[model samples]
Target: MNIVVILAPFSLALALIGLAAFWWTLRNDQYEDPQGDASRILIEDPEDRPL
Candidate 1:
């Protein structure tokens, strides 16, 4: 069907874009602090305390 021809390329383009974004994050060390973020939630900021 004609729809398949159009949809196939569109889907492939979306997949490629997602892959590129993932690769960019890898090269930028965006995932280096995976555990830091999780533990950070348990830590409180001193500025947030009631005076």
Candidate 2:
């Protein structure tokens, strides 16, 4: 349909935008350490005493 022609470019633009964001995040080291946060939870904070 005619709507497809209009919507396809918009959808493709959005997809490219998303892919660019993903690439930027990867290049910027946004996902360098996936497990670092999980392991941090196992370490107890010394500032948590009854206050």
Candidate 3:
């Protein structure tokens, strides 16, 4: 169908774009701290200075 023909390329392009973005994020260490934030919340804050 004409719709399929038109949509297939668009879908493929979107998939390729997504893959490229994922690879770029990995290369730049975008996901390296997945648990760091969660663990930070459990840490106690240091004593506060007197006002």
Best by lDDT: 1
lDDT of 3: 0.89
Q: What lDDT would candidate 1 get against the real structure?
A: 0.95
lDDT of 3 by residue, 1-51 (tens): 999999999999999999999999999999889799789777776753344
Root-mean-square deviation (CA) per prediction: 2.9, 3.5, 5.2
Looking at candidate 3, the ten consecutive residues that score lowest on lDDT are 42-51
TM-score of each: 0.82, 0.73, 0.69
Off by over 4 Å in 2: 43-51
Worst window of 10 by summed lDDT in candidate 2: 42-51
State the lDDT of candidate 1 residue by residue for 1-51, as single tens digits: 999999999999999999999999999999999899899878899986679
**How well does candidate 2 score on lDDT at residue 15?**
100
Error of 3 at 18 (Å): 0.5
* Cα lDDT tens digits for candidate 2, 1-51: 999999999999999999999999999999888799788778788885456
Candidate achieving the largest TM-score:
1
lDDT of 2 at 13: 100
